[model samples]
Target: MSTGSFVSAASVENHGVVCDCGLPSPVRRSWTRRNPDRRFHTCKGRRVENGYIDCGFFRWYNQGDPSGWQFLALLEAREMMEEQRMQIAALTNEVTTLSMNAENDVKSKELGNRCEALKRDVQVLTERCIGLQNVLIASTVGFGAVFGVMMLMWTSNTA
Candidate 1:
């Protein structure tokens, strides 16, 4: 008899969990939670019934490996990582919008100031024109007013 040399299916299937040969075989159990079920097979060769022509083997089908827990853990980790990535993207978008709004505000204020300066310059030029016109009208009264013209009528002045 080969001792410690035969390959146990549980080791290869369950990551070295205790083999069911230590327990019984043809196992089927249902518990709470999603109508959860478990099924597996071990190599401790149970006998079949009488009038059976096959060997001393019980074939148990529909038995999945013991990867349910590990797969769940992996799925949870992936979901957490995806949530973190979405948060980062949302934060990045928020930061970009804030920065652009700040820049636009600064530019708008600068343009408003420039427009005010141009308005002030136009007002100053208009006031200067009005003052120059007033000065010319007053000087023309001294040189060619209606009374200075009467003096020129005293012999057509320089004629």
Candidate 2:
């Protein structure tokens, strides 16, 4: 068929879909225009044969533009690139989150160790203070007894 009109395509969702003659043709992909983006396909012949259809195959354009296969390849490549970019972004975010969590864990462990060390130091200091208090009390009692004896001896000598 000679290229005349555009080959427009549309998607239809149906549980039971059939061709014009009621023949079953499983859908390929959701549906896409043959060359509606840039060029289209149409029949140049009259609509008489093939059950009032122009030609068995429609005619779009390929004179100035690229072929349909080329356009499809380009579209597929773009889709793959988009998916790859999304994957990379997700992986980067995961790595950053993991690093932050690791750093927090280390800091928490260090704080816990410091708290334990401080508790041990407090225990040691409290024990030392108790020992010093006991020694002070004993020294005071001994001094009082010695002074009492000294006073008694002085009184006796004077008498």
Top TM-score hit: 2
lDDT of 1 by residue, 1-159 (tens): 123332223323432323334434433332212223333343444446754232233333354533577556655665687799999999999999999999999999999999999999999999999999999888887767777778879758668
Top candidate (lDDT):
2
Q: Number of clashing residue pairs in every model? A: 0, 5
List, residue by residue over 42-157, the lDDT tens digit for candidate 2.
33234455655433432333345545676788567656877999999999999999999999999999999999999999999999999999999888888988888998999999
Instruction: Note the Cα lDDT for every prediction shown.
Output: 0.57, 0.59
Q: Looking at model 2, which ten-residue stretch has the lowest summed lDDT?
A: 24-33
The TM-score of candidate 1 is: 0.49
Off by over 4 Å in 2: 1-67
RMSD of each: 16.8, 13.6
Model 1 segments more than 4 A misplaced: 1-66, 150-159
Candidate 1 differs from the real structure by a C-alpha RMSD in angstroms, to one decimal, of 16.8
